[model samples]
Target: MVFFGDSMLETLGRVVVFLLVVLVVLLASLLSLFFVMLRTKRILFPNFVLFIVSLLYEILCRLLSFFRVDPTLIDRVSVEMRNALNYTEFAATDPRERILLLPQCIRSIDCPARLDSLEGICCVECRGCAIGELSARSREIGIRMYISPGGTFTERILTRSKPKAVVGVSCYPNLYEGLLKAKLMGVPAQGVPLSAAGCVKTTVDCEEVMNKCKIRS
Candidate 1:
């Protein structure tokens, strides 16, 4: 009985060591991928490569969570990873194939945009908020624009519009989810994180979206 107990302890120690080794390896790979992305300011890889990189990033995040790290830190890392995905190609996508998705939180507090059954925000260009400005700019570029409240609404809009590519603007949490959704759908998607902070009455960098839209123009 004493021998058996000693052997079990040894086995458990070996397993722990192996797991630690793996954790270190994964962290190193994730950091390496991150540095490469930072240096290039873009992923510059095909979808296959991007998928692998994103998987590594997500794995690292999960592993870090085991350490009880702050959730916001993980979110920030996710946002940075999402941003480095080299949307250069997506820039040139056909306007018909692209959709610029904005968040409802970006609307003016008193704005009166109505929603339709098809998940469309009927913005009469009221100029009540930046959405109007963005909507008008997107129209000029001949790209479709809509306001999605969250992942579910964005999913519905994607299904209804069936856009080939998407550019979403939102806070880090929602933006991360939307980007993941886009990847799952095999749609080329990019996101812009809201510069301002908070859940409501937030603002986005409209110029960045316009620059992306102009990539195809």
Candidate 2:
């Protein structure tokens, strides 16, 4: 019994050490990949490599478990991966008080597809897009989130809200407008360009927004 207990302790120690090493390696690899992507502008390649690495790592972990090899290392890797993925969702600071959300264009009162701000408008929550979710989250965090239809209304909202920073989601034109506003107001701001993939509503990941708002600690 004494010998068995000792062996089990040794095994546990080895598993812990192995898991630590794996976690460190995984983090380093991800960081290196991020830097390479930035330096080489090889966006698609890095994304592909990350996917492959993640898949292979999971498979290896499963295989190890099938052979009764301690899965602690794999489990650790999974947790780390999840955390990294979720990191984008985490706001590094409680700057909720300083953040704002704005919309690029307002919807037409008659047609959902047609955007019209010729008369100056605002998002009406009629399209059921990310604006609603972002508003809710901002409310929860005490941040000011608004959906202004035009630059004029956007400035109005910003002035009333008196935010120290802003987060805008829109197309290139609106993004540029928001940046200009930020500069003029001396407020820090960030923008998320809408992609052609049409993920404006439910598909928008709050994690991505969080990533944009993340501050290095």
Task: Please report the candidate that would top lDDT against the real structure.
Answer: 1
- What would the per-residue lDDT of candidate 2 be over residues 1-217, giving only the tens digit for each residue? 3566878999999999998798667655654664465466444343344354455556554655876866444333332332343333333435665665645432223424334443233345554555555656666666655655554777776776676666666654345445656656866566665543232331345666655654433
lDDT of 1 by residue, 1-217 (tens): 2656878999999999998898678677655665576577664333444455456656756766776764445455565555556365565578667898888887787878887767666788898877889988998878898887554788888887898788888877677777888877877787787878587888877898787655652
Determine the C-alpha RMSD for candidate 1 after optimal superposition of all C-alphas.
Answer: 4.3
Q: Which run of 10 residues does model 1 get worst, by summed lDDT? A: 44-53
Candidate 2 whole-model C-alpha lDDT, 0 to 1: 0.53
The 0-to-1 C-alpha lDDT of every candidate, in the order given, reads 0.73, 0.53
Q: How displaced is residue 38 in candidate 1, in Å?
A: 5.4
Clashing pairs in 1: none
Q: How close is every model to the real structure, measured as TM-score?
A: 0.75, 0.44
- Clashes in candidate 2: how many? 2
